[model samples]
Target chain A: EAGVAQSPRYKIIEKRQSVAFWCNPISGHATLYWYQQILGQGPKLLIQFQNNGVVDDSQLPKDRFSAERLKGVDSTLKIQPAKLEDSAVYLCASSPGTSGEQFFGPGTRLTVL
Target chain B: DQQVKQNSPSLSVQEGRISILNCDYTNSMFDYFLWYKKYPAEGPTFLISISSIKDKNEDGRFTVFLNKSAKHLSLHIVPSQPGDSAVYFCASRYPGTYKYIFGTGTRLKVLA
Candidate 1:
């Protein structure tokens, strides 16, 4: 079985530049999630999508960040005018159900100078 | 406030020895706990889990123990191997919600 897939495994951008990360989850998985992992910290939930509809995004910094899962299959996370603090690994995960073991991707490392 | 914490930043164990990793949480409302292992440049993978109502859940060489009263949990790996070396994270899910709180993670190194 194929695992979650992510593109541009590494990204570098200067501060105030916009950046985006892409994620393609495992087949047949209905629940997708995006997380941010800063150095020395655990992955923080940014948003969750249950078949293209957001289930939770309370922790997301809406003023600068946005994400969408179109057609409930693929997802994208974007950050506009990225700040130095935005430099972190962006991880995408998916699960077969709303509540179950989640499979993760290699993650896209974003470096905002 | 940080709900989940793994006070131990790192651990080292000899091959074929037992390795124990601990986790603690401040919130008493968490109902499910999970353990995930992560390799360098890779995302976390589920290792094992236990519910709030259960004290122990074992799977092969991995075992998870939950102590609700103390708000503590642990993961034990028997006869540790070099391949088992990785960062381990503990996460808890809020009751009535799918929200999960994760710890900073503990890096385990099993020396061969």
Candidate 2:
């Protein structure tokens, strides 16, 4: 079976610019998640979506970061006015449901200048 | 606070030897533990998992041991191969929580 899919495996943008990442989860998967992984650190959960509704986003940067899963199949994460500290890989993952094992995508490596 | 931690930043072992990686978690509520392996430029792949009730779980050459009393878990790779060289991450999740807390990760290098 195909795994989770993400678009634009790599991205580069200037500070204060807006950048967006897209994710298409595995077929029939009911849960999707977005994570940020800085160098030398583990991936940190940014947001989670169960179907079309959000399950958790307490860690998300409400001032500049936002995500949505309109149809429950595909999702997008956006960062407006990106900062240099935002330079990291954005990973997308999916699972059958809550508490299930997750399958990850290739991830989008964002470099902010 | 850091919920999970992998103290070793890196480890090198000769091929055909045993490689042991350790992880410690501060949370007692976590009921599930998992190990993931990741190669450079690639996302992490699930390797093995153990529930709280089990003290040990093994698959192929990989074995995971959990010590609830010490709040410690470890991943053991026997007859380590060069292909096994990758970053290893330990994760834990509580029974009812959907989130999984991950460690900083430990990089293992198998020298041939």
Candidate 3:
């Protein structure tokens, strides 16, 4: 079976510029998630989507980050006015259910100058 | 507050030796624990998992032990191989939540 898929594995942008990442989850998966992983740290949950609805996004920075899963199969995460601190790998994952094993994508490494 | 932590940043073990990585969590509400292995430039892959009720779970050469009383858990890799060299992350999730809290991760290097 194919795993989660992400686009533009690497991205570079100047500070204050905008960037977007896309994710295509595994077939038939019901839950999708976006996470940010800074160097030397674990992936921090940014947002979660159960089908077309959001399940959690409390840790997300509302002022700069936003994500959506319109059809429940693919999702996109966007960062407007990116900051230097936002230079990190953005990972996308999906699970068959709300709780269980999660399959991850290669991630998009965003470098903000 | 950091709910899950992997105190050791890295570990090195000779081939055919045992490699033990530790993790500690502060939240008692976390009912499920998981371990994920990641290679450089690759996303993490699920390795093993254990529920709150089980103190131990093993698959192949990997074993995970949970000590609820101490709020500690560990991943043990026996007869370590070069292919096993990767960053290992521990994660915990509460029974009803969709979020999983992850540790900083421990990098294990197996020297041949």
Clashing pairs in 1: none
Can you write out model 3's per-residue Cα lDDT over A12-48, one digit (the tens) per residue? Answer: 9999999999999999999999999999999999999
Candidate 3 interface CA RMSD, Å: 0.6
Error of 2 at B14 (Å): 0.6
Residue B49 displacement in candidate 2 (angstroms): 0.2
* Predicted model with the maximum TM-score: 3
| Residue A58 miss distance in model 3 (angstroms) | 0.1
Candidates' chain A TM-scores: 0.97, 0.97, 0.97
- Displacement of residue B82 (Cα, Å) in model 1 is 0.8
Model 3, runs deviating above 4 Å: none
Flag the better candidate by TM-score, 1 or 3.
Answer: 3
Residue A88 of candidate 3: its Cα lDDT?
98
Residue A102 displacement (Å), model 1: 1.0
Worst 10 residues of 3 chain A by lDDT: A95-104
Lowest lDDT 10-residue stretch of candidate 1 chain B: B93-102
lDDT computed for candidate 2: 0.94
Instruction: Candidate 1: give its CA RMSD in angstroms.
Output: 0.9
